[model samples]
Target chain A: MIGAVPARDATLAERLRAGRSPRRRAVDRAGRGLALAATLACVVPLAAVLFFVVAKGAGALNLDLLTKPAKALGTGGGALQSWLGTVQMVGLATLIAVPVGIAAGIYVSEFAGHRAARAIRFASDVMVGVPSILVGIFVYVLLVLPFRQFNAFAGSVALAVIIVPVIQRTTEEVLGLVPRELREGSLALGVPSWRTTLSVVLPTARAGVLTGVMLGVARAAGETAPLLFTALGSRLVNIGGFGEPMDSLTLFIYNGARSPIAALNDQAWGAALLLLLLVLGINVSVRLRSMGGVRA
Target chain B: MREDPVEMSVAAPVAAPPEPQREALPTAPSTVPGGAPLSLAPPAAGIPGAAPATVPAAKIEIRDLNLYYGPFRAVRDVSMGIAANQITAIIGPSGCGKSTFLRSINRMHELTRHASMDGQVLLDGVDVYSPEVDAVDLRRFVGMVFQRPNPFPTMSIYDNVVAGLRLGGGARKADLDEVVERCLRAAGLWDEVKDKLRAGGTSLSGGQQQRLCIARALAVDPEVILMDEPASALDPVATLRIEELMLELRGRFTIVIVTHNMQQASRVSDFTAFFSMGEDRAGYLVEMDRTARIFTNPREKLTEDYVSGRFG
Candidate 1:
């Protein structure tokens, strides 16, 4: 019987080792080629945008472009005022939104019942897809009209509305990635539910969740439509507190892009380059940090 | 812990019914309102609540336990005594609910949605499921080690050992240091890990990580330790080490282990309880006795068949 088994197995092995037919080989090659094409389809556009911005914007770059405020009528000055407004407003927006978004995310992932979680998740998904112009209009009606002035605080609130959904959704997804085993292990140690969620679950998911927060900040920094009806853009540096009008990089690019003056147009390209680099820098660093760190 | 994946159920022939014990256990299903009719399998022979006078005082006594997940009964009419400061091994075929029965002792099964139980699990004669008894406090006394080695991924080795005490309240740094060393030594891991207390808990190898989890369990100073197939995921060498540790810990804590490995059960346990699934697919205990008696001369034919490697 053993000899018969070897004889049968030899035939099976011979059949399995038979080379792929010409048609199958051709199909496999075509599939590989198609996948490569799809990948290049994504990369080519991104590479072109980066190349064009650097090529056009690098010539316009100078210390004066970043450090000095824009000229009164001409384009002989920089976007110090614009960039500062962006920093303050986005920072303020982060302060307002991070706590609320993270708290809701934790509640949905760790405590809510199935129906409640689903409802909140659905609401956030819808909010993520809502138009930024609509958010600007809503803030216009809610804060700008009521206060009778366009203020940096109103702009921060508008950006915050856009940011909350991104942070909430990403926080929920990242927390979900933490293994159920970790929670069980903590609970089995006789730790109460709240302590388990706070000390163990949150720390385990910290890096991934922070990456989400950074992405949200990047998204908020580049928004112009929401600030159009809120901050309303200022030409001269308005050092007046958050209650006054503000100018941001996005607002600077928007106004500069529309100017008839050639210098102003060139400065628009420089501002665009700076905005792109900032967003790209944040995304790259976060990706690298999450990829290289040992999760344990 | 949401409904463990069902193991393939082997069709076990129906054995003759056991003689019913006195004191018909009242069924008080915790989750199901208007207590569901208890259609459980016939109760088995080991009722330590009414055992012969010579049995040692039971550290944990289970009385007519039936566990359910949603509507399906998983463990049926399990009543046995785990002797004080001794090791009791629960051995069974896959899908016979050995793990479920073990979890019920510490109320760990209640973590699963729709999980409920009927009857009593007494810890030192106090009904652990009583309303006034906090489940979290109960867990502090009855610690568990899981099948997989799950050390907190973000904590340092030292932090993982002191997690329970630190969470409960303040512990002096000196006390924490002392507990860490004592528990790690008890778990046979101090020599391997003493120099790297600040290293991430998950930096250790799989066997060492399992020992870390054991040391974490030991640090809480639990009166009873429940190990649910704690060494099954490990290699032969690691498995032997865990067995040796259990033997070393035998008299200090009442240890209850659920294992699929019958050799492991015989090697480390003082008493052995054999479980088998009835025709309805709810697991019930067949017999419980001294390990030597269960292996050499069993009261039930099923236990003999299982221990002799004739069948599971």
Candidate 2:
């Protein structure tokens, strides 16, 4: 029976008995090569930016730039005061934003079955889509105008407004990613719904939630527009309360970049590099934590 | 001329009269032993307060049960008595309410938002549908195995088996370990999985996953077990294993299974109930009888036609 068929007349199965044909095989190889080329094309620009930042900024980085006060407009300077102001303002913003944002996200994901929940979710989405500059203007009106001056507290409020949407959206998405089956299983076991959410669902989605928080920090850390109208860029950092004007890394970069002196320009690059490194570190740590969760 | 001479000495025995034979036929019309006329009548007259003479007092009784999804009635007036420690298999084709009926027994149907039922499901002489009876407690006494094996993917095999027991309340470590081992052994999965009890339940093969589900169900120590197409998703070998396990479990728990496999019903069940869709496409119980008689000599022509593979 096998011998009755001609070699070329073999069954379709026999034709496919080996692997791919030479022409098709070559095509597959070419397809893979094209994919690799496209990937390299996308990565090259990022690599160039990093290289440029390191080359220019590395020359200006020093302990003095980190530890001393900023110089006046005509002289060589430092970022110590700017760094302290950035820390205080951002810290306060984070403290205000994280809890409220996360709570709102949880409510939307877990309990928002009614019209109020729908309204909150819709409002949050709209807020997130709104321009950051608009948020700064709103905060400028609400806090800076009423107070009759730009202060650290006004800056923090602007930053908080921006941070809220980022944190809220991320938290909601992460909580939504937790499987419904897990929640159902917990509830079926006689655990109260809220307890199940807190102990089971939240714990399972913790890695994603942490990643969201990190992203929120990274976003709020580099915001310049909101800080401009609120903090108003003081040359020397003042570590006082809501009434005192403050300086941050972003404002320092903005101001130094606009200065006529070569020293100020150099200082801007150094501060930019510092901000980049902090954001990068946060991102990498979040990635590592997420991977650790998956492995476990 | 020879026949005439031979007939002269012949004498024949007289046959009985037709009237006597007719009278005897009425008396022998299959007496249901304990012989209650009321029990023999159709359920349309409604079962009286007197105990059902057709079967022993039901371990589980469903009455005037109607299930709906939105406005569509999926099942209507499904009343049946499930006897204790017996394997009762509900067999029907697709879309026939066998699975729905099984789910309603433990109120698992309540999980669907659009689903609703008007009924009374009694367990051990108490109405499970009563407002005072907790659904969670009902589920504890009447456990279910779904068509597909859904052992929680995140939980380990050991945890999957102990989930129900732990959910019941506090269990000592020694007692838990013993119960887990016993349930696994009862499911015929202990030897294969004992060494890897800590492995995720999802890592098991399809057959092993089904067995793990059975083990999970057994861990709760349910008095009645409801299985909805438990072996339908399994291969022939796995199906056989589940059939064997059902037979073994029948010694302890009342097992009510819904299956499309007639051969499986005949092989495992002592009693079989046949269901079919009515004119409205709503499912109803057509007939129920001893497994052997249902297949060989069904009283309902519809059942005989279905069992004989002439129609479904």
Candidate 3:
């Protein structure tokens, strides 16, 4: 406006000409079909899995299935031990993983020099790629044999090792999303670096960090291979004290799903449903909190 | 790009939230100073410039300063003396290092990796670049407002204003209320926001948010306030309001502003420094003079070209 130039005539490209050519419409149709195929390719499998799982497990659930312990190798039993054991180990692992993981994330994102932080982040990404079974074995040898017994604690240690890198990497990435302006605003107030990170950076990224934490917890909860060598499933509802063998839904499903017994098969379906629900619950809660934060 | 703060329509329903009041801001929160948290309606004696001991001297002196980002030298040896309780405007085209020079006052440029500098920034004749002078404490005496309005998205309006005090710690509620009102009043934002102090800082309009950022800076009672294109994102009306607030703030805080608008520099500043980058693209000051002289009759040909809109 200040320069005072006259408006030019509209170019052909700008005069509502998009999607008018026959070739354009054909390309558009192709793109739509391909995208639909891709979407269905993913959604079909997921929907089938949900349907099959529900169909198989729906009739299997009763109060007994949840409240009673497995008897005679998961035949005519409720899977109570597996439920309790899954809760304990996942809960324990989350307790151990969350603090250390978040701290490492903060250090990598905020404090470490570029090269050093990159090295750590690279290691974390590689750690994520490491086979879960190998993590189980590493913990099995380091924790299990040294403690001279199988125990829930050993399983927790293994799960926590697997969870740490995921949460740490996620936290670093999520914290990175917090704009530099907020960090500068805090620091420019004469607030110390540490205080700035805690009060401003962390709080600003609260919803995202919670997503990372929940993802780690959900991952640790359902893992079968990691607990296989460490937890060593039990039939009774033991608290699975530090050195005691424990039970988990994944352990139950792995062994039961392969068996010929009809009752054990049904129990496996129920266990799968339960684990799926738990993960779903965690994901839904994360979404709700994120939405609430935005709305507020 | 400049915007004109479009005044809201005069005809409004009864339930609408309070708009910016044109008349005088609500009186002193209508309560005693340092008393309760203004229950019904709705105060900076400790401010650095208030003392005669600290007045009438150069507040900040930048000497032989060079700033670098890794191997690229962005700013070359530039020197300037800023008088206390006066507004100095820094004007330049884009990428001219005016913003970089402003950031050096509070040592904010050092926050980025590989950003290094060689300079002496003296506050009250004490070198801020010396190892013993903590950057954190130095910022309290010299505050900054950014080009874009960046109120913390998570914090409420009142929280954003008092954030500096809370970070310093040991502040009572009564003290916080007083600072909030005083700072908001100084920024010319008290009347629009006092009722919705608990609302998110981001809920305010763009112009109001910029003013909120100003209030946040003023709450620290900074000896010097550095603003980097503070009105660049606002409407013309909002820009004018900020300009008026700058004049009102004269004598309470030594102000240094970086702006691209030559008219704004001529209108508001007591002294004007013109900066431009040369062949190597490293910005350096071309001229520094009283505002009237710089705008009407500058000694440097480059300054004349920039001011007369012949060249940038």
Candidate 4:
């Protein structure tokens, strides 16, 4: 059995029992509806793209598509050469970009003086905003012109240039979030500044840094314009060396999409789906691993 | 802890002395390598209450120290001797440069951008700021604990304790294990954390985390430990435990603690230095004396007023 509630509790219960006025309730519902509409505005385009890609590309998938190289105009072979080139070029680009990007990030966040840090940050921002095609042209002039060849190395260089600024900015932001207290604590224990940064600061921001790297990798893997000037798409596989022309999934999609034949266009859709899945798979796996990765 | 003030107050009246006494130098002046002469005489200006009472052994001597953050003076003209094997508490209100003064002892203050200090902070009679001394090397001799518990989030309980030792280069696993156990026990956290030495440092509660930070500070075996309000974030019970830990460790290390809690200063410290901000917003030492005398019968009117709750 319950006894009489205290005066304060009684008042609180009475207040709880009261409902908002009709005008206020209507306003609340309208606000919630607006929020839902805004959310759908963001999600609808993404859902539509995924739905159409799967619908159009699923029938094009086959063993032949996987096994054969590109055939002549209108006729189909496969994206074997393109897939391999993408793997090699993007892989090399990652190797070049990650270390340089992370090092530059660390310098800006942990070591650079005020004016120097500002200048570096400004340069990175400007690099990020520069058009991807311009990066391709820049690399063409820098590496292609100097070497007298449109080679996979120049394509990888352009991709790496594109990736570096994205990774650098993200790394700097993530490292900035690592608390100042952690650095001070480590330094007070007689650990040098550089050691503290490597051990304590970086590890704490590991998951975030990995996320940034994945974003950079995904962007580099999908870039077609940059590869156009440098890689100069090849129908035959060029796997012997970086000095030869290369074919990537983006180039395959570009060529197939523009072809007059319906079959090549379908294959283009298939390759787009494949590239999207590959990037998605890498991102999902990395996110899951990082979630369970380190306590920091 | 409640009974502490009562017992100390009873002893306070009996322990009062008529005149202030200077702390005797702990060791001979020759111990200062490079023959840096020890200035035995008090400062010529003889700032009031600067040297109010005696301490057992002087471990660190600060002479004419003025700390600046860019153009603003934070701590001005502080001269004092921190006693070895004892806890010296620095008490002041907010923005009074209490933490700045503590950081200067370990040269941690210089880590802040635009932060600088002149005059001498002598560790074993050698100026720590001398061109020959490396700040990194000097930090090995003086460890510090911040107000917030900052156990490395990336490390486990055991790893956090050995983070400092790991820097000197790899040590035998057995040696690290021993250091971990010894420091945890010294911080009064061994029994609670021993079973889960591999657990994340952040898995512990607020109180336990603070104790872990203390254990981390102790791991390097520094001769002096500086605490900047180490327990201000904890509950009263945890605060008492930290105070007890400081008291127990006083026999082995020189401890300089900056606290906002007056009762904590009166309870845990052997010597108390009261700091107050001047009109220009620069903090300076108002009085330094035995804990008992400083609380019971301070010589300066400002010290008495602040202690009695008349004003800050």
Candidate 5:
């Protein structure tokens, strides 16, 4: 009689310890699978684009493509002229934009209540959303057409127009990130307000500002739409200012890719590859600089 | 268990010994016809019902003071005087305008664009809020330390201590070095930080940073020092050090401190003002008296309740 009762109790315990409901188990498995699928979906496109660019462009990248000038007439040569033009124009644009952009950003972030600052911020936001081609047209009318010619200056102005809003917006956002206690501490020292901003607040946000400026440069460097109307195009290497037409890699690619000759097409690919590498190198440097700032 | 009779006599008074009846009170030096007495003594009883004028003739006096932030009134119709070379602690719970009262003394609240005040703040018998008196100069006379120790994070300890002196501008190298040494010593931090003068102020421990801030305030040689919860962020040992420093500071500079710690008020202050909330949550000073009497035998029920930890 005792053995029969113990056996019955054991059977009841086994029934109570049964596995999870089938529907709940299926739902948990499906949730895990769905999360995995979502993550893969987001990553796949980025990996594919990186793979395609490296695979298609790596063979054409060499020192010659970087050091020599573009092809003559319909023949293959190099991208030195286009490369130089890109550098000069972007360099000039940066020189013009960084100071004005950063100042405007500081004004907006530091004096948010002022009417003029509000207007400037609004205009910057509007400008950022405007198409690059519109900026090119605006510059063509306001600058290039007035001179009756396209030149490196016109190209730079167009690029500056595009870059200014980006730098201003990013700088304002970064400056806003600096804690108010830092500013207040300096002010409490009887330090004049402007000096406090320059000496204490700006140094704290320097890395973020630099990263923003570099990102602006990267964005403006590859802009084919703006340069199409501003710099026009040229096969020969020229170093003149606003008076003469200039060469750029984007224009070189656009013009060369249309050529019937196979050699010209190959040179165009090399120029494209060079542009990519330059931007990539800059991005890597910016990342390293940001990491260094974090550690510091 | 043997207390001296002299100590008992000195400790017995709930209020200052009634100013030797008017006839015996010393008159001011007659250098200037209408100049007030240099001594910080309570006013004689010429006017009736003036609440016995507990506060002495002012190192600092705020008269009919009203503070506003846009539409909201923070402190209203408040008047008080801080005595020379005494420690006055303003104790109340959070948002009772204790910190506000402290900041108003140095005009530190004026840095806020929306903050405005209507009243007279007299420092050394001169109206600090007068149009001719610069806020910067006012701050030099009445330096302040905040609730949190903020020692200019980017600056070295030496620079942090000397910042106000440098801002005062144009002192010779010997004078500056002397002042830095004197102020750091007064702040009780010179011995610990003497070797690390070049290290960043932020590299110091929390208590050290607070002491550094005190040193920074001392560097300016202000006649009055305002501290708002200066020791609240520190550990007990650090807090004791700061309290001891306050006592040391009291011999030289008049100090006004705002604290939530009732025990701190009793331990470090010569006078304590008990502030409490009213119908609209507006804070008003319930009583100001000798610290010993305020703790042991407060006159006001609210003051008694707060000190006894019955309610805040």
Candidate 6:
């Protein structure tokens, strides 16, 4: 620490001088300052958005928003139907996508031989970049036209299509991260390749895979473009089935924000806050799981 | 498949008639006469391969083996007979394909993409390369412990021990407890781990985890256990413990180990095989002999130099 050389600061100054020059110290301080500024730049906008939504919406956001319906629009109406529809469609989408995405991921990372896997990988990367509105249009043509209706099932199909590629990519990357040593150990015990994957490989990558699923859910929950042509929106509190048109927070927010009524706009802001909370909750829980969850 | 003396003699056991064909088969076995070798091969410190004139009963017969990682031949034309219930150590410098030779015995080498092998590895004198012999089944009888201790992080100690039996097929629900205890006991881990059987395998100390892996290998009751520098990642005491455990396991399973530690080879192995990379970068067997003879009086100059630490 160069304790013998310093007089004014009892060796602190000498230690600092020995470790880093003045220019290097200044550079380090500047680098730290830049990093903090960058972090704040990201966080400030998010905080502002969250605060704005809550401030405008908190009055309308009550228990009635969950339990009651938006029966009297342009009045103090709740969005019970919209919330339920959002839950149903997102649930269906998750159900449809999770298994298929994880399976595709396993195929790409584990048994994928040569060019076919590469092509599938390439396709998934491209899929992630396709415009969300374009995906909505694609689903509209495929499902809405085929069924001759804008139904909850069609909405779910759109969300699932968007979610599948994201989850699959994450599963592939995390599964690939599992060290080859474990595979060999399992195989050396005479475990078949499929069983090894199921029992050992999949479990090891479980947290990361779950993170992917949650990320997909968050992304799909916030999407308004895909739902515009699928679920459309309805005033009914409880739609009969997947065949019926559904009401979602995003769709309601989209329709209400442009309305002239102040009450309707307040309800839209309330729905946005609820949707934001749901997405943020999923993301936060996923990060928590990733930090200290059961890892193989 | 060709009716060579070794193949013809070995084939009799697999295809023997139910009645009396087995009686005549054991009389003139190629590796041993009357099949006493597997049971009666006494454990003496490095005595099994002591005499160059007397060859032990070969449990595994690897002939003209070549291993390739794509176009790059990692190991070339290597042939060695591993004795039944005896420890054989393959010692060499880094990238010498000693570990490759070890992995190819159970076909673990084939797991890598584009990895290919040309040759025959006979287990109980049956060609493992034959299409009829499933690699999965071959691995059941010929197990391997890696250089790094890889206890399944997802599993408890009890589960990790019985992982082989569970996933490797032939595990009965009723026998799981017994099998886990037996394998752990055999691996010299029962006394330390019996109380916390439900604890995660990864929570154990490094040596304990390695032992847990060994226990996992033993869960399926393999006849041959291949170790690739099993103690390299361990501390000195752990290394000594593992070496001692190998000595104790000698008469139960045929052991083939790859080690960079020459003292360990001298201390633990019955037979020592030296591998060196040629100018082509393909590893070849330089010499195979009794540990005592190879360490003291060697045939190959390369073996002597390596043993003396004159050069890698």
Best candidate, lDDT: 4
* Order by DockQ, highest first: 6, 4, 1, 3, 5, 2
In model 5, pairs of residues that clash are: none
Residue A159 in model 6: lDDT: 93
Q: Write the per-residue lDDT of candidate 4 for residues B1-312, one digit (tens) a residue.
A: 011112211122322221111124544322332334344334432334544335444678888899999999999999887766568899987899999999999999999999999988888677899999988877877999999999999899999999987963434555677778888888889999999999999989888999999888877767789999999999999998898788767656678999999999999987899999999999999888778889999889888998888876
Candidate 6 residue-wise lDDT, A1-296, digit = tens: 43334466556756566655567777889999999999999999999998999998887788988687877544665888898888889989999999999999999999887888899999999998888888889988998988899888989999999999999999999999999999999999999999999999999888889989998998889888999898887878755488878898898898889988987888888899889887887678777867663344
Q: Fraction of native Cα contacts kept in each candidate?
A: 0.59, 0.06, 0.51, 0.70, 0.14, 0.79
Provide chain B TM-scores across all predictions.
0.83, 0.83, 0.81, 0.85, 0.83, 0.84
> Poorest 10 consecutive residues of model 4 chain A by lDDT?
A1-10
lDDT of 2 by residue, A1-296 (tens): 24333378778787667455666767889999999999999999999878877888888778888888876656666888887888788888889998988888888888776687778878888987787788888888988898798899988988888788778877888889887656555444434456556766676677777777787778888889888888887878588666878999999889889988788899988888887887788689777766642222
TM-score-based ranking: 4, 6, 1, 3, 5, 2
lDDT string for model 5 (B104-213, tens) is: 88777787769898887777667778899877767766778877888776578887788776655523456666666777777788899889788888888889899998
Model 1 chain A is weakest, by summed lDDT over 10 consecutive residues, at A1-10
lDDT of each: 0.82, 0.75, 0.79, 0.84, 0.75, 0.82
Give the CA lDDT, 0 to 100, for residue B131 in model 2. 90
For candidate 5, what is the DockQ-based docking class? incorrect
Error of 2 at B206 (Å): 2.8
lDDT of the structure predicted as candidate 4: 0.84
Error of 1 at B171 (Å): 2.6
List, residue by residue over A197-238, the lDDT tens digit for candidate 3.
Answer: 888888788887888888898889879898988988888887
* Model 6, position B24: C-alpha lDDT score: 20
Off by over 4 Å in 6: A1-29, A72-74, A280-296, B1-53
Q: Write the number of the candidate with greater lDDT, choosing between 4 and 6.
A: 4
- Candidate 2's residue-wise lDDT over B249-285, tens digit each? 7645678999999999999987788888888888887
**Better structure of 4 and 5 per TM-score:** 4
lDDT for each residue of candidate 3 in B1-312, tens digit (9 for 90 to 100):
001112221122222232223112242211222232221111111111112211123566777889988999889888676655568899988998999889988999999788899978877667899999999988877888988988888889998998877875624566678778777877889999989988999999989999999898877666688999999999999999999888777655678999989899888887788999988999988877667878998878888899999887
Better of 5 and 6 by lDDT: 6
Off by over 4 Å in 3: A1-27, A72-74, A286-296, B1-56
Query: Against the true structure, what is every candidate's RMSD?
Result: 10.3, 15.2, 11.1, 8.2, 8.6, 7.2
